[model samples]
Target chain A: MAMTEMRKDDDTALDLFFAEARQSAPEPSAVFLGRILAQAEGVQAGFCATPVQPAVRRGVRAGGLGMLLALLGGWGGIGGMATAAVAGVWIGFAGSDTVAQVAGYAMTTETATASALLADGDILALAAE
Target chain B: MALDALDDVSDETLLVLYGNGDRAAARMLTLRMGPLAFRVAQRMLGDRAEAEDLAQEALLRLWKIAPEWRTGEAKVTTWLYRVVTNLATDRLRRRRGIGLDEAPELPDGAASAVEQMIDGDRAAALEAALAQLPARQRQAVVLRHLEGLSNPEISAAMEIGVEAVESLTARGKRALAAILAGRREELGYGHD
Candidate 1:
């Protein structure tokens, strides 16, 4: 009975102490919620991708494409080699444009078209229309 | 142990449930402990934006660890508080290299003078008092009083012994009360 009474008293004191302390201040606003959620999303994405192998997926897709391209080249001879060389150069240039766009989006203003398309053609076509 | 009688379950149990993919447990734990965690981070860092981020990060980490959480170990909330405290300390350390700025003042509310007067600058005063304490002392005060943890629980949270918790809480409270009490007349806190 005495132990129980002591426990009750201890609980009461703890309650009162916290009650007084909780009167300190209010919480952050909904704006703060948006900020934290954005951060949480970034952290979650990083955690989710940690153990997954992007290389495996890329390897499977690339292997199939390589096999098909090799078959077409073998059948077409010189024409096929020319086509493949042109395609590779064109792809390299296209990849460069894409990398520029992404880097621009991350480092600078995404809305800036000049930065979004450092290469001449993509924006020139957009402008022509 | 009584389900119906459980006003609030400890963070450890909530953690175990959340780890097991109990969405209800996760939500309950967040709502139950979010305010306390946020307050502790805010008090320690003196920056609302950073504090909010730190609190969310701490909780997210808790969620990530839930799947592997062991029972009969440290209380979940204590672990969370420790994470928050450590994160806040890191922010402070980083700020030292990058010159920490004064916290931006919050916008004033549209309440009447009486209401404003009652709430007038109390938050500001509390923030100032919190800024004056050492990081560990501030954590002790916030954990014991504001966060409502027992000394033993605080020891577990702070990774210190119960006696150390007691010493820190006493010193912290005395310092905080002294700071707040000093501004009582100027801020009109003692009038009512």
Candidate 2:
């Protein structure tokens, strides 16, 4: 009975001690709050800036490359036309035997032109794909 | 969404908004969780500067992870509590062999003027007694009594069983009582 009474007294004192102790929760310093707020703002800033970048970069690069290829292909077509005109004159000045050879050469050149067209066709195919 | 609208949203929702570049959400979460991080760190570490630094680091980590915060995996405060606890433990390990003779003073913000006038000595005595406790017991008791966390919350924070938390708290209280018994005259509780 005496031991139980002593235990009760101890419990009461402990409760009172803790009750008084708990009255003081330390307030966070202003400097700490400021640092954390600054960091949160920094993160929020990154989230705002990231999403629109990659798509814009891809669009600009692909468009520029396509424009350059079109300009180069147009310049190369002038050279090909001039070569065809020269071949026509040479065939006219030569005989029927030369004509056959010239015709054969023209056929071979046409095949090469056809293959070149096929390569251009591949660019369109790639775009579609 | 309006700040008024955000007041009703959960922490996970706030983090999602924070990831979506919502400044209000970040502000709200900072206002809510920053003090919590500070309070826990201050109590556990018992040093003003170290607690402040730990709290800052914890909040900084929270910001870095906001973009990838899993929606429902864990509560926001729960995750931060674990981080702060681990940081405090790491600091304590680095500070091994130091005695707790110089207990840090608790802030007077939560104490009313009446409390300071009437019970300042008792409060100081209690803090000194708390310093003498083993770290684990001190943490358990502080979380249970001073911080008013539930046994389950203490278990999660301490990563221990609920039974273990209860045992620590009990033994810690007994030890506190015995220590304070020696200074009842100064503590103003006259001995029989």
Candidate 3:
């Protein structure tokens, strides 16, 4: 009985405290909603910008194409050098039919200059050394 | 119709409606819950302007979350109350270095017709007593007493155990009593 009574008293005290505290609290002004709506509108605007994804994809594709072209150019340069080397061998060995036919099978025009450049001196100097 | 007519509509339903760009639900939820948020913030901060700002910020956050608000995880009002409480606690801690003498008095009640029943000095004294309590204690007390949140709800909002909520409220009320005890005679609160 005593414990129950004590609990009741505690409840009463708590209630009285609430009643007092509630008196001091005020209602929020109307402008708060307007401000919230404005923020929401701004967020909506940002979401509207989502269509830019396609442009981003286009940029990625452009970058991929550029990389592919660079790789092709590098391999083309290497192929040209191999062709020129074989061509030089073909022309230099024309007196021997076996060597001439073997050279012809391997050589192209661009390879000859590259082969000369590699065999020759000052043109191939290292930059730092 | 009374505002309670819309209580049949669940908070989740209103959130969904608001998500679908129904502005009416936004207005309704703000109208219904804004006062509670403001009251909680005001009690915690003891400053009208700062409390208003915190309440507005909390509402804005709610608006931002309306698009993806998952229901049943937490009550909407509870979340707003917690956000406002946390914001008010931050502002209170930041302003702690300042002297209390210069702290602006809350708007005098007697100046307005509705608030004429309240005695300004007594109200001011109570607010001062509230200021003496630690931020957590004050928040626990306000959420329980001023905002009428249950112990479990207060625990969820405050991110504390129910026992901690109990302890904080008990200590807070005791401290408040001690502080207000001096002004009891002046405020006519000691008598029936």
Which candidate number maximizes DockQ? 2
The deviation in Å at residue A127 for candidate 3 is 46
> Per-candidate interface C-alpha RMSD?
6.6, 2.0, 3.4
What DockQ would you assign to candidate 2? 0.43
Residue A66 shift from truth in candidate 2, angstroms: 13
B-chain TM-scores per prediction? 0.71, 0.77, 0.81
Q: Mark the regions of model 3 whose C-alpha exceeds 4 Å error after superposition.
A: A1-14, A40-50, A54-129, B1-7, B97-125
- The TM-score of predicted model 1 comes to 0.52
**Tens-digit lDDT string for candidate 3 (B1-192):** 234555678777777676766556666676666777777877788788887778878877777787788878988878887888888877876777643333333223212222232564555565666766778888888888777789999999989899999998987776666555445555555444
Question: In candidate 1, what are the lDDT values of residues A1-129, reduced to their tens digit?
Answer: 496664454444434434544785558676655554454444444544547654544323456666775566544665868888998897797888886787878766645745565667866877889
Clashing pairs in 1: B19-B66
Model 3 DockQ reads 0.24
TM-scores for all predictions: 0.52, 0.65, 0.63
Candidate 1 Cα deviation (angstroms), residue B108 = 29
TM-score, second chain, candidate 3: 0.81
RMSD of each: 23.1, 13.6, 10.0
Error of 3 at A12 (Å): 4.9
